[model samples]
Target chain A: MQLAHHSRAGGSVLVWTMLVMVILSLLAVEVLRAVSGRFQVGVQAATWQEALLGAESGVDLAVVELRKSLYPAPNGAWQDWTTVPGNGVLSHGLTTVPNAGLAGSPMNIEVNVDAPAQLKDPATGWQYYRIRTLGSLPLSGPPRVSYNKEDNRLRKLTLLNQRFIDGLFTSETNDAHAARRIEAIIRPLGSFDQAIMSVGVLDLNNQNIVIDSYDSRDPLKSTNALYPYNDRNADGTLKRQENGNIATNGSILDAGGAHVYGDVSTNSGTATGVANVTGEQRTDFYQDPIPIGAPTWTSINPAPSTVTNNTTLTASATKGAASSRYVLRAIDLSGPQTLTLAGNANGSQTYIEIYVTGDISLTGNAQLTVAPGVSATIYFKGDVDIAGNGLVNTNNQPGDLLFYGIQPDTGQNPYVKLGGNGAITAAVYAPGHDVTVNGGGSDGHVFGSAVGKTVTMTGVTNLHYDEALSSGGLINNYKIVSWFEDTR
Target chain B: MKLQLKKSGGFALSEVMVSTAVFSAVSMGLLMGFTSLERNFTATADFATNHADEMRISDYLALDLRRALSVQAAQNDTTILIPAYYDNAGNPQTPALDGRGGVVYGAIGSSVRVRYYLSGSTIYRQQDSAAPITVAMNVKDFVFNVTDLGKVVTTRITFNPTFMAGGASAAATAATAFYNTTLLRNSRTDIASSVY
Candidate 1:
């Protein structure tokens, strides 16, 4: 009985052991499957990320192309990018990552742009345009239709057309993860016609401030409406216009006795000094603010300057005298300084663009000059402090002497200050900050138009709006206003 | 002669009890191991899924915000409204502008009046009056902190993943946050003055 019992117990033990082994094996399999699934998910996540980055890169390339196509000529001729191929598509070569991750895959970029359409306001002649960009991963093999010999010719052709369009938006996988679509609306930054435009509050403290207009583009015009309000042009010529003055988005507080010779418009805030404004003073005229984009430093000749903090740039200094384009980090010119353009014999004007990365001080006699048909532009990334007889005199047209200021939100208020006895002849676009003309007891004047956060006149300063600036050829760059991604 | 042959058929009662007890203990241990492993595995999978969803949501918002002419966050930072246009093949669609220069989106575009919001635990995206799409799921919170820097706008998104797995509360769950500062690609004067 004992022997039989021992044998039976041994058999039962073996059976139980086998069952345990089987259970362990099944558990192991489940663990392996779970691990494999997790790895696959990780892989998919990485691919989706790559796809998104690829799409963004495609957009960046398109923007570069747009910049190249739209930059105006040296003679101030507009090269509208929207005119390219009318409703056609432009393709950038495929980009592939040649590493183990996402091996042998290429991302293609197709940019399609529609023709420009006129805005509702016909007088401005501003055209609005739209651009669409498709970023996709292309299929690795030829069409499946080609493998079937019995396919009809029409069917093959139809398949080819479908594949072609699909290639622009669809990826190799039917899954939408491999593709992205973005669309943008674009418009140009036209000329600034008003003598002064303030997006913020404007306080006029001077009584003798005279604002007027003249058409510099038309040489046959009657009398000069330039500075001194004396009916004499900057070149001693006679020209005049009854319209063109100040406009503001905020309130215009004219302390008693201030006078504006032309129209005054405030889109938002109240214009309190009714007695100060002469010609048609209209309130609540909604005006669109000018938009600005960061300037591309690519292809700019002469390396960026290494000048550091609080450095002075005199006419005699090495940095300021260079006739070539100079990118200054930060500069100060408190005394008399004249920037002259060289090599001007064949009417091939001197071309120079100065970019200031920090604060700029133009106190006392600060002047900028270019011979006939020559042009110069000053781009400021920070504040511009002009005070105490500081003058930016340019012989070229107001449009030729351009001042483009991009405000930096570094706690300091970015602005173009016109202190007492200071003056400038340039089209100013500091769309991000304020432009102040103050304390210029009798001689402060701004020849061109100002488009910025605010325009405040607290002195006997005058604004001379050049009617010729209304022409569309003055090239201000375009910026994206609205961007949307196609979720589908 | 009497002690010659006695046949015992099976195991003694105590021996049987010991074997059964041993088998039960081993089986329970195996089950426990598997259960622990599965819990960890499930947690990992849920985390990954949540991460991917966060990324997708962030990508969509970033892309749209980067090119947005105007971005307005409303309803206590729970909703965002954007007015934009995109070119569909050769057709150009844009949002209608209100008399106050605000975008009255939905004039004629995919989403002239696009809005993103959070309701309960799901993030939803809608265009005009169109039905909302689930932007992300398994979400505990969706919030936007928008800051306007003159020409450029920056937005921060906070996404939290809850610990609900298989209809049961998970012991561990972490929230994901994303910060993006998109310079307005399109220049729209109205964008600067828009109030959210």
Candidate 2:
């Protein structure tokens, strides 16, 4: 019984030892499994992070390519990437070799450009454009991985167009109030001659007024009336009737409520009005005003009451209407006809009309003066070229001079030149071509109402205003006019 | 024969008593050693896991705090976007601003905003955006400080793990656990201070 008991007890002890060992082994296996599982999780997390970084790299590459294509080169021409020669690769060192999985997978990038079509020359087909690029990065990664994306960008550019209008208008004053109140209306007919279509009004003040009859109030209308206030039309004739009205489809009145049968202008302070009309008005008024039955003065052969050359013209002019209205006409001189006046004469407030059947030229220091309450009208069939220190003065408070031209009835190619330190306190009006005030020193002022189809300042010209002035077209002082072109 | 049998019986009884006493003593010693070892092992494992988790969360939060860009305040100025950091893809997250004001190193909290502050050795993280996660309790010392033009954000957290042995209370465990202070530093000095 003792031996049997000993054996049984030993066997039970052995079984208990075996059970402890098995339990220990199982626990070790479980611990090993847990550790391995955790390590595997760490590896998986790292791999995903790497994949995300790779995707980010692709985005960076696309941005670089976009910036490169948009920037201009040193040359005038812009870079073109549309017709990429081989494999559509832009030769700026941006390239990628195909990997094993994504090898030979052609990645095509397309750039959509939107810009002004007018910039492209119809003949050369060269144009400026703003480009938006979309690059596709095709990949052969695992099915679980996604690798496609899109981005957008914007750029601005300029191009050349054949139908661009190059013209400028400069204000002679710094007053914001004056600039806001003064309006220039320019109407051009036929070909647009920059030289003949500009009007310069120098004495701009707080109350200065410039009425532009040619400028169209509507911008969308492509007819002559389009862009009334903003652009110059091709006709070259800007008309403002007596009351300050522009004749378009009908009579377009000025802001001052004036009626103008033809183009009308006044000094800065003049309260002028215009008459309204509708539809295109008759262009007949602009025709040559020379009547066929008018008597022609062959010559001042007897030399009308001539005096010493030094005597100023104002001292000798007769006060009567017959003497004051004497015509010193010339038959033939040069292409520029000259009439030399030498006398000491004065006249009552009368009208002095100088009619030139052809181009008129005035030389030497000729002084012509009209007495108080007097008005003079100089008519020339051709251009008027005045040189030397010539003085043409109207002594009356509201004295005026109207220069009418014949031939070229279309209001083109007419020219007026004023040179030297000449002083003229008179209202001068012209309809066609241009008026140039040149050679006057900085101190002198030309006080007048100058209405020209286009007025340009050739040299240093000072315009002094005792009253008001207006113009029908553009006023350009050549040196500073180029900056206003819209390059976009 | 009877006398011999009686003497053997006494010897047998004495042997039984002696064996029982020895067995009892040995079993008690072995049991005590096993219990002690088990407690130590469990304490080590729990301390390791807790420390690791704390370090991981600290690192994650430190990264977010370092990359903070701007702090924006709500209408009341009581709540603000603190440590507002943008992700790699430029997606903005809250906590736009960070820094210390007086003894508190945090910004204002809104309904969906949070502020981090330190009091003594305990670090409290409060969020109005969501229910606050205690994050770490029984901390011996916790500090979030800035330096280097507000670019460097350094955090130090100290805790005790030995107190956790034998199912101890958090306070007790924290007091007795292995005391370790971890310093987590991140570079995001451009982050503006919280103005909220």
Candidate 3:
């Protein structure tokens, strides 16, 4: 019985051993299978990751393309998908899949791209665009990643005119015509006391202007007929007007006043002054201060026995035709005249007074030449024309010759020309006109005062002591002979 | 006594026969189980390894393709070339196989060339004077598709492996080879718009 029990136990032990071996083997195989499955999973995940990266790469490419198009070809449109050369294929041994699961799969892929939408309309404002990309991997083919993108761009816009009255009015309706018709009157009571009287009428296109002198000499004349008289005392105590002759009692008889009617033109001299109807007191009318011995009579045939202080000269006359040539010499005038200095001869030592008169034309090769070291004054009542190569040399001494004129109050800045190779050294006073020096050969030094106008020197080599006291003018293209002051 | 001895001996023989038959059946059953387990383990290992390799390959492909600037193809359309910039090196040689059985990769001019037969088993990548690097071995097939936009480029690559390790052969069979599709956008637009 013991022997039999031992054999059975041994047999049982052997069977147990065999069963354990089989279990161990099965466990090993299962572990190996699990490992293999994990490997396959890993490979799949890798492939998906690669595809994703590829998709990102595609998006980057699109960005680059968009940038290129927007900058290089601003006017060109952006569309379509493009392949980068050598990008489709992989490097040797870099991505080798031995015994891969899929067979005959297409590794190379074509990308279809949608049109890029505008992000912002420049005319409207901000805009945006949607970009979509698809990376298609065929069944049993190489994997591919599809890419999509959306972007935005900002747009900007650019005013053209900014001036007042650029095209408002024509040249004829400008301010030049309005100034000539208006005149202001001033009355003097004493040395400092002054008042405004009645205004006067003047031609808008008048070439000449004149200021009349007041007379105070005679007595026993009624002062009421003087029109706008300044009676400061108003106590019936009459005083003689400034720049006038009066008697000892200071009672006015002939209250001397001047009148300017229409536009005065003349060929000879005439006396024009205001007188009282009774003629008890005689007075002389004067605008400027008369010298103590002015109008000195030199060539008198028969000297008058007693010179009357009340007698005065203020009228003007014209000499010679516009076409005639005349040589002017030194002469004295007790009154005004319009002397035309024409001809091929030179004018020397000539003195003339022009109150209110017509135009003075200097035709031909006339030279209104004032000799040096001599004094001369030409007071023009009208426009002075120095045409046809005519020359006016005002340089007589350091400060000898003077050209004085009352410029019409027109707003137009009329020009005065020294046209030849002549030099002028004078204090020219034109209260309302601009002085222009034109001509290449002309040179002069002008020391003068011009109110309310510009002194332009064009094509001139030299000018001296020139002053302008207003605006709306320019001084250009000329050489200044000496220092000048401009008060504006 | 003699009768008892003869009977016992005969019974012993029968017992031995029965035990042998039983042992043989048990052994066969254990052997079959172990064999099945071994096969499963092997399949798992293969799958894990192949998956890792696939991941590595896919990553490499994506990175290289990302650097692609342009693409060129041979006249026959079987060979493709890719020009790419790598790091600060500016230009680097990178050739890939098309999975065909032909000579499909080399460096030509300034581009990397890739060539393979449509029925090739391995994808070969070659550069000038450089030994070819096999990108995908035991590959069943490979294909490439390239798309063109006027200013942009897209390249797609697909490949299949030959060996399938696990019962996941069905999944493997349906599985597509790793592929990278890249779009190369034009870089001139930004520069063109800059006035300076």
Candidate 4:
């Protein structure tokens, strides 16, 4: 009986020991699982961040492509990128996982652009583009057709065909964990965004000045976009489109009862004597980046400028064809020397680009004439003084002639003065020069826009802003006008 | 007769001793296993909390730097000066002209100075002279480095482990160091700006 009892006690002990071991093992497994899960969470966060960075890089690459091939013939091409069919307005580019992201693995970046939008009413001109990009990490979702065939069921293309359908959402990022998409609109910061923009004070000393706007592309606004003020507003104003606005980073002084038919803005301080102006006078304006470098004509279709007497440059081919360029050290015409420019009215317009390294002084009957169908732009490095017969645009279109001033990295303050009667119809941009229109109090009737470091009109001037310039003219550089991450 | 019955019922001394020894060993083993389970659970929970803090710090700092016009930090300490942007209902308000027509800092509902500094183990984000808002807790180490003229910001943050056993290795007690380097998209110069 004693031997039997001893064996039975050991048997019960074994059962108790087994129960304790099973419970302990379960707890240990739970702890291990929790630790593993946390570790994975950390990894997931890092991968998502890398995906975001990659997407940003991808968008930048797309911008480079757009610049490389800026649509329309002679300026650039759309070579390596895929141009969407139906209207060559869209382009797409992709970077696969082989291209290392911020972290090295399973990440892909993609970018697409809906570029150079046109007006729906079919007037003319094109600008402004929308871009969408995707950044993906550990892209082991559904497979995509463009992805690697060997990794069939591992990665997916998040967006395609210009429709990230769930677009226009908050920045609440839809694709950060595995995929993300962002969208941005781009445009150029040209002089045409406003009528008159100056880095310093904008002094309008003339009371008879008619600062108004007209759209050259819109027929309903003018007689073939020539500006007789076809539209009238209830406020008894001409072409009350009110787009003949003016802005300055400094202050506006001595407006002197000017009939400004547009908005006035002085971002720095106050706007004095602007009581007769016919628009809102605001003081909250941001400065534009007009720091564009000089043109490198040596590298781009170089042609020496050797004309000293009366000269005429005919149209090369037509619009969109390669425009001829001439780089001259200086353009100094004194007493009877004339420079004539002619274009074709038969849809084959002439386009010319001129770079003047030194001063451009025209005095005593010295004339620079630009005929119809001629579009010319002058990027000058030194002072520009137009007296005597001055500069004349027979086309009477502001878009036909453009003057952009180039400031050196370090030099004395330069000047762009227009005291000649012929230097009336044009657009002028000199970010660092004092652009003074010494009209001598004559019929200060001027056309187009002016952007300078300081703009002063001493005479009775009527400056008209061509609204068409806002759509296409004098584009120095492109910028992201609006950007957002489509959280949707 | 009674004495004989009692003697028969009693067990041998060796038998009792062997049973005592086995039970004592089993109890000791069970106790040690439970202690280990509790320790692991607590350690893992603390580690996860630290990781959550890392993610939070990165998100806030990166967003602020990307939109800020400038950033400043004195050293690799738990302090950093952010860009000129004001907080409006959890949103960053951009720089704008005040009624005085100039960009002055700390104007009401306008651009304000945002600074992040440490207080003991707690991190606070101070906007102007306003009351500081707590951001993180139990941070053991922090580094805020600004380079490339406020265009590049690098940050490293570490949290202290809650429990450390005796004779534990240095690595076992050391928590993860979360590091990140971000660029100011608004001011970075490496991007392509002008074509020619």
Candidate 5:
């Protein structure tokens, strides 16, 4: 009986131990399968992320291509952007960097400018482009596909698996297994297109101030009573409506008599005893104060090799039409100063840009002249003072000569004081300080815009706004208005 | 009666039965654990796939709506009108003005006219009569609601998706909803229109 009982207990222990071992083994197998599945999925997720990065790389390349299109030669010669074939799509393939344990994928990009979706400026006829880009990475092929297709029956068995894999990566019908689309609206910065733009109080205290516009491109185009400022057609007929629009962030106080030929927009203040305003006197027009920041000064042609600091020129200084730029730290014209910019006789227009750091004082009949078809712009980083009959003389259109006051000198209370007895026909954009036009006896007839903080017209000054300047004759940088991703 | 019956040689009937019962109970517990793990895995995988699909569709809709000029939704489909212009190099062709001084914006460009709707279990996007692109599949339900707030337009999207896990026998589902408000960039209010 003892032998039988011992045998029974041993048999029971063996059966229980076998059962427990079998269960544990099966559980371990299941756990291994789950872990393997998770590893595979994780690898796929990493590939997806890498593909996205590749797509973004394509966008970066597109931005560079766009900049090239805007200024093709890089020497400031204008080129037609719309002339590029296939809407500016470049045939290029990008392979990502294989560094830091990452074997990047090969990406392809295609760019399309939605011409019909472009935005056009009504007054200037300048169009903004909407660029669409498609970035893609090819799909990975299944392993041992040839073996699976060796037999027709086996191929049939693998069809469903192949379909599943394709569905996982494919987007639309394109060859790109992983792909993304991006649409961006790029608009040029028309920051200085208006006739007058100011950031301070404006005062029109002159009685004989006449503000109007005329097209200087044509010598015969003039402002008259019946035509106002409209351009005449070839048959001497009015083409369309033209007006010289003026605006001020501050007040426009006409203390005495004044005649404004175009619309007068003031953010604040009242017009007192104004003789005539052709356009609407909009009091509700509000404009934010323009900030006076340092100039970007990007790739200005004929870049100065060295900066001119604290230089006073009393004799005549001549500059060639080709590659002429003056980057000065400080400049003063003492007496009888004449600066001349010669024309390029090869029918190529000459362009000149001047940058000043400190105060620019023009005293005792200082003059600046340029030939026809020559464009010149002076950028001042400090106060500008024209004390005695200083003039900027140019026979070209009013848009040819531009005075841009970008920054204010410290403690100088940077102001534009035009206290002379000569007419200056140029556009002045000073949004940091007040402008004082103190002259009389047919002296202060400004052909272009006079934008200042507080424009106190204490003399007989007339401001004329050229409608042609509002056209696409000015240069503006491209800006991205909106950017987003499309994952369709 | 000197016969000491050699103690019963094997286990008693009750002892055998009890051992068998305990073994059966432990096996059953292990089987239940495996089933629980599979169910949880299926649920997690389903949620991940659904979330990814929702994100893709959401991004596409937001970009389109923000650039659209006007949007109108109906029971069957939603139509979006996008104003388009062509740039002729630096010299853009002047837009024609009507008698009322309104700019006569002509036909929209290719791929600009978009319509989104649901057919069967798939969401289809039709662009200028192109082959309908399947934006999303296995969609159990979808809804689009548009609200116009003067200059701003808001669009609400809802998606309920169901996908097959393991095989046709095992089906998993996820539901999500979101609202995206877009301020129409180009309102089509130009100087000519306002003046007229």
Candidate 6:
């Protein structure tokens, strides 16, 4: 009986020991697996971040291709980009990073650009585009370690059963790839890129000349989007904003004490009195060529209207209506001849293109008034002399009144002269003419932009450039207005 | 009956010695296994802690560099200076014009300056006149390469080991440096202007 009991006890001890050993071994395996899993999670987080950066690179590539279209090209080629048949979008096929020849890029990026959408100012034909991009990095490939000494990249962490390269970490067994999708909107930047652009010498030759800017689209900058600005400070005081810029291709000289509330730049030309410029004063600047050409008139129905002294000449056109044209003869106003330009009587936004064949010589207090709701562009072929009360813009919208000097095929010298006390709210575009802005004490406000071959300003002419015009001109450059990621 | 009892006592003595030896061997094996597991767990925890610290610093610096208006050399103990262009909730401080056409741009670019500095192994961040607070610890070296003209800022950090017993960690580093480059946003072109 004693022998039997001893053998039974011994057998029980052996069985219990085996069971405990098995349980302990399982726990060890589970702990190691948990540790490996934690390491893998860290790798995934880093790889996803890298994928996002690649997606942004795709967007930048799309912007470069779109900008190329701005220049004259064959069929507006976007560098071999194909069109999406359904949406007409230009798609850049999936391409590996680092271009070709460069090694160690394990990512791919693709770009797409949609067709242009016309802007509000249909006359300019300005447009914006939508761009989409896709960036992805596959982790299913064999894991790689070791830094590329040739590329001078930092050495990756020697992870256990993992891979890390170029700031991206991944597991050797990871089969799924991460992707990032981004969409951005590219739009034409503001029109009047600057307050003034001169092809020749721009002389601010007077001390009392003031250069400032104000935005008419903002109610705080202008009263009801007009003049008599709304006090943006809520302090019941009108202040000039420091964005009234000026630039010239030739020398900018003799700016004697003229407080330019904006920037001044020139291409290999000196700018005098830079101390007076509140904004940046720079040289060696570059600008696009300003070409002021007359538009080809359609000569459609509703014959061109003629303006007479003491009469209201009406210029009318509705949305989607055929553009209208007007004829104004070059005549010297001998007395107090007042010509009123009125919009459509039906309360429609009307725009007209006027053709002036002769010189406009205003003497004494002879004034040409621009009524409300009228947008006019006077294409003059001769010299303009506004010596009287100047162009009286009752609407006070600078963009509403534009003077386009047409390059005459063969004619007399081209010049535009403004010498009156009345505040002129108009943009003058004559790249080949000598623009002279004289007279006007503190009450003389020239609220517009000027692009002349040579602009000479004197007296106390307060050139209050309309900041809103910056949004008007043709698309000078491209800008990303809005960008976001598509999480889906 | 006397002979059988004597034989039983002698056999019990031998069995006790053998059983004690076996129990001791098993206990020692188990103890060794547990000690090794504890060491590995500690080594992994140290490595993870170090990696997390490095990631945190890289992410935080990238964010700060992207939003900074300017990156100047630490003057009088200040390492970096960022403007208050964003509020506490990460929303832009928009400057609005009043109904009277006047704009008070205090909200757009405020006078509040977010500053950073390093003291020994700790990095402290202070906003304007506020007291400095510790942002990071155990830093061996921190360097900033600022290209003002390019509007780019590159930051590199060197960290000390959390546990020196891991035989050179796979993730954390003491000799190798981790760096990040960030392009700035909302830069004031007038202050430090660059031409393309």
TM-score of each: 0.48, 0.29, 0.26, 0.49, 0.45, 0.56
Q: What residue runs in model 1 are displaced by over 4 Å at the alpha carbon?
A: A1-45, A69-101, A117-129, A138-177, A189-443, A449-473, B1-28, B56-77, B84-111, B115-123, B136-196
Off by over 4 Å in 3: A1-488, B1-57, B72-120, B140-172, B175-196
What are the fnat scores of the candidates, in the order listed? Answer: 0.29, 0.00, 0.05, 0.02, 0.02, 0.00
lDDT score for residue A31 of model 1: 71
Per-residue lDDT of model 3, residues A407-444, tens digit only:
44345434344444444433443333344433334332
What digit string (tens of lDDT, one per residue) describes model 1 on residues B1-196?
Answer: 4344333446778999999999999999988987877777776656666565555566556655654555675531333445534344424354433322123234533235557777787767676687976776656545655676645666666544534444432223213555666655544445423211
The CAPRI category of model 5 is incorrect
Q: After superposition, how far is residue A356 of candidate 6 from its true place, in Å?
A: 5.1
The fnat score for candidate 6 comes to 0.00
**What is the DockQ score of candidate 6, to 2 decimals?**
0.05
Chain B alone: TM-score in each candidate? 0.63, 0.50, 0.50, 0.67, 0.62, 0.60
Clashing pairs in 4: A69-A77, A175-A179, A175-A180, A391-A422, A391-A423, A444-A461
Global lDDT scores for all candidate models: 0.55, 0.34, 0.30, 0.62, 0.53, 0.61
lDDT of 4 by residue, B17-51 (tens): 99888998998898897788678767768767766
B60-157, model 6: which lDDT tens digit per residue?
Answer: 55545544555553422334444443456644343332222112123533434556666786656676777875555555344323334445666665
Which digits, one per residue and each the tens of the lDDT, describe model 2 over residues A163-267?
112211121112110000000011111111111122323222211233222212222322342212333335653332122222211122121331122232322
**Candidate 1 lDDT score at position A318:** 28
Between prediction 2 and prediction 4, which has the larger TM-score? 4
In the order shown, the candidates' DockQ scores are 0.14, 0.01, 0.02, 0.03, 0.09, 0.05
True contacts kept of 5: 0.02
Counting clashing residue pairs in each candidate, in order, gives: 21, 79, 117, 6, 5, 15
Kindly list the per-residue Cα lDDT of model 1 for residues A1-488, writing each as its tens digit. Answer: 88998999999999999998998898789777656554544444455455556666655555455555544233222133323433333333344444423546655555655533322224334444455665555323232332212112111122233323444443334422345566655544454756667676666654666667777655444343233344554686555665566777665635344566676777655666657666766676554453444455554435447332223222211222454556777656645564444335565545556787887776666544455545666788888776665544445367667777764565767778756565666677786767775645666666777777766667655667787665443334444445556543
Q: Lowest summed lDDT over 10 consecutive residues: which window, candidate 6 chain A?
A: A146-155
Ranking by TM-score: 6, 4, 1, 5, 2, 3
User: Candidate 5 lDDT, tens digit per residue, A37-129?
Assistant: 544333333444454455455445544554454431442221333234232332333333443112444554545454332355554455555
Residue runs of model 4 more than 4 Å from their true location after superposition: A1-128, A133-182, A206-208, A230-240, A251-256, A298-307, A318-323, A344-348, A440-442, A477-488, B1-196
